[model samples]
Structure formats: structure tokens, C-alpha cells
Target: MSGVLVIAEHRQGELREATLEALGAALELAPQTGRQVVTAVLADDPQALAGPLMGRTHGLRLMAHPDLTAFNPEMYLPVLEDAIAAAEPGLILMPHSSQGMDLAPALAGRLGLPLVTDCIGLTYQDGALTAQRQVYGGKVSETLVLKPASMYVCTLQGGAFEAPETSAVDTAGEEITLTELSPAHARRFVEYVAGALEDVDIAAADILVSVGRGIGGPENVPLAEELADALGATVSCSRPVADVGWLPKSRQVGTSGKTVRPKVYLALGISGAFQHQAGMKNSGTIIAVNKDPRAPIFAVAHYGLVADLFEVLPKLKDKLAG
Candidate 1:
């Protein structure tokens, strides 16, 4: 069997946490399928790769090229497609970020392979690889299996896998080989538009307190902010909050907003809409406070409180303060 390949995602020389998570998922699949796990990095500077990936995986391969300096789909697609052809990997794992969403399907189309997007879980049974993915806005989980094709590409949802710990491998001695290829298409990145809060990223926060429509109106956002302050966590909002301008789009969390895997996620007055929960279902410990017990958030929450946020939040904050 061919080995499993994990595509390393980096920007400006920094490795994204999702890459390690994908590596961990790939490692889990490797033992079951009896295939070696290899990580392929596409970057200009090969020396900037970090984390315990070197010692943990079976091998590491780097594809360095000047064209990869900026993320260009036309340029990246051909390079990744060529790498896939050369490696003939049984499974190709990628982070389900914006870039992955754009490139995975195109690559699959080019290679004539089946592609799965936003996979939350992966397992093997009866010698077949199965993936658990959310459908209908996360209202349902569908299991999918791949055929005999050697190439299977999937984008993993953020926070789906636990971050792997670094091993004692001599990364300094590891040598990376580069592949040079010319892009068939030409497109240039004009400029990058920065978000309002450049330094504040909700995805990287450890604790998040998010608000939803159940909070009433934009006037009630202060209550959520107060709760966030009490917990020493960042404040985010559901899609409705952003759509109504109660919160900035930068602080939105859901399928349309930023996907987060915080250590502790407190959903106050959020009814657990599928679009909203898709972004936060991977939180380490989820606590949802809603008056509607039938709210879908409870399905994935570790702790649920069926009560009015107006009454419960202030008291909870007071108790925490005392």
C-alpha cells in the first residue's frame, strides 16, 4: 500500500497548528492501513518547518519553489498535482481552511480522484476508509467511503484532531528535497486586505464566550462581554450577531465566520444553529446556556444549562467574582 501524505500548510515561514492536527490524524490512519505517513511542505524556505513532525512521521518531504512564496491556486494546483502523481499516496490529508477548500477540489478534479471536504472524523472498517462529515449545515453526520483509487483527498475541520506532541527526532539532520516545476497558469496576488483586528484572532483563543440571537438584541451584547471579562476570555458572536451588526464580522464564529477550537467554549443564549455549531463543535469543553432544552447545541455540549441568560449570566459572574 502506498503511504499517507499530509500536506503541510504554512504562511510566512510559520507552520499552522492545523497541519500538526492533520499529521496526527494521518498517523492514526497509517497504523490501520499499514502505510507510512509522509508530510509534504510547499514553501520557499525549507528550513522554517517546526513542531515534532520530523520524529513523529515516517518521513518528511519538502517542495520548495519561488512561485509558492504567495498562495496562488493556479500555481499551487499544478505543483501539488505533480507531487501527488509522483508519490501516489493512498490518502492525502489537508487542513480544511479557505486555501484547502479552494485547492483540494481543483486538485481532485485534475487527478480524477474522489474528494471529501470538511471531514470531522476518519476510520477504517472492512478494509475501507470511512470519513464522518457534517451535512445540511451540521444537522446530520454522513459516513462516506472511498473506492480503490490510490489517491483520496480530504480536508479536515479545525480542532477535529488533537495536536500531536513532538518526538525526540534529530530534526537538524533531516534533509529536505525540492521539486521544481513551471506553472501552466499565471495569476498574481494584487494585495491582501487586513481585517479590523489584525492582532486578535478568535481561532487562536483558549477561551471564548459567544452570543447568539437568544441574547435578545445588540443592546444585550454588553452582558456577553461582561461574562467574557469574568472568564478572562475573548468575546465572539454568532452569524446573526454579525449580520445584524451587533458585532463585527471578525468576532463571528460559525461556518461563515472563523472556526475555533478553544479550550473552553461558553455559548450563552446561542440556540446551537448548525452553521454556528459547525465552527465550535470541536471545542475541548462546551457549555451551552439556553432556555430551549431542545436546542441542537446540547447534542455536542459537555454541559448544558436550560435557563434564561439574563438571569443566569449575572449570577454566574457574581459567584465567580466572589
Candidate 2:
């Protein structure tokens, strides 16, 4: 039971993508750290939650309770405490999302364990685990090594690691556990309200035609729209474009905006700064269009076009439309 334990995050009857990414990060560090990877899925019927993680992790610990249907910190804390006692995990990994942000700190404080959040990468060396995070608005990266603590808790940043694929044959048997919990006193469970329906959520868009400062001005934003329409893709932009009010903040993609993992990300006029890349680097197919051949964006682009976006935009639109 002295292995790594990952607290799986799920919502709306489905596991979040961040959970799989956290699993990937944990599996990557397991070999060097000499810890087996175990996942903890807590729900009213934990068995129902085991499908996605089957064969993707080294082990599974399922905690089931009727009160655990929704995410309530009060109910979750007791279950986690019991799991920790039973599993004796060397390290605990959680998603750096709403749920993990709320649960990790409190759990760490209560357990008197070291905790690191929003870690973009994890490395194990010299018998120590190091976590990497962005600093100064993603201008620089800082590494942290927590020592003297027998165990540590970390929250992995979303979209930082690739999602692991699931298999059918190599599923690890799950261990069923239970925890007793009183009703939530601080906050009671209420109905879940969905966010307002927007014209498009760039994060959910499969294909994104994103513009940058190179779009020149708001008047030229329509050019990106024309191309996006031709490609049946949503139009998103970088921070600078949103700063200048050429587009809504919701359309911005970067550290300061929403992260996107579109299948085809068309970066027009983007310089490929780390801030912007942090949002779309995981996109399945990245095609960067910029006049500067030396732009940093080309480094991550699967396809790079070293030409003026203005000239290429129209031709590309026509070709796609054809």
C-alpha cells in the first residue's frame, strides 16, 4: 500500500479529462519513484466509475457511499482519510481543477503533509520528486522539491500531460472500501446549475481558427471569421487580441484565458509564445501561420507555414471551401 494514489475527478456522470492526464503524469513518475500507481474513485456507486480507468492504472480503490453522489468536501474528506489509512500512499495526485483546488489544500492541512498545486510536470531524480510550475504569468518556470515529508500531495495542471488510453483485457481488479460520513454542515448539497449557453465555448470547439495581434485590427477580425466559417471552425484569439477589444475575452486562448484542445488548431499570425502555447499545445493537429519563420510557435506546430497570414488566409479559405 506504499504506492502513489491518484484521486480521480469526475463530474456529470463522466470522468474529467484532467483525471486521465493526472494518471499519465503519475505513471510517468512511478518508475523512477519506485511507487505503483493506484487510483481512488469515490462515488455513490464507485463500480460505475471504474470503466474509464480500467487497464489504465496499476490499481483501483473504490469508495462508495450514497451521500457521495455529488462533490461535497465534507463527505469527501472522511473517505480520503480512510483511504489514506488503508492504502498508505507515498504520494497523492489530484487534478488542478475546481474540485482538486478545493480538496487538496484542506486535506494536506488536516493531514499535516506537504502540498504543491498546479504542477505542469513531475520528475523523479535522486530519490526526490520535483514538481514544475509556471511563474510570473508563465514567463518562467520554477521547480519545487519537497523534502522531510514522508508523503506529499500534488495537483496536476489540466492539459499538461497527454491522456492515457484505456484497454479492455488488462483491467486491474478494484478494491471496494467504505466510509461513514455525516451530512454536510458547512454547505449542503444543492441543485447543479449549468453555465450560461454561449455562442461557442472555445475550449469545447473541435477546430479553432485563432488569430493574434497580426490580425492587425478589429476591422480585420472578420477575415479570421471568414476563414473559420469556411473551415467550420470557431474563431478564437490570443491575449493581445482580447486586450485590444478586437474580440471578447471568451474568445481569447492563453494562460489568461480558457485552455483549448481542439483537433485542428489553426494559429494565424500567432508568435507561439509559451503563454499561448500553454492553452493549445495539446491540440491534435497544430498548423501555425506566421510571417516570421523564427517564431516560437513553429516549434510546436505539426505544420508550419512561413508566410504572411494575410496572403495565406484567403487562399486557405478558398481551398477549404472548394
The numbered model that scores best in TM-score is 1
> Model 1: per-residue lDDT, tens digit, 121-207?
987555467899877645577998876555688899877787666772233323444456566676776766665664368998899
Error of 1 at 156 (Å): 0.9
Determine the backbone clash count of candidate 1: 0
Give per-candidate clash totals. Answer: 0, 0
lDDT of 2 by residue, 167-284 (tens): 6225475656565686445676798875445567899888999999899999999989988887788999998998888988889887668889999999999887666887888899
Backbone clash total for model 2 is: 0
The lDDT values for all models are 0.79, 0.83
Candidate 1 local Cα displacement, residue 83, angstroms: 1.5
Error of 2 at 245 (Å): 7.7
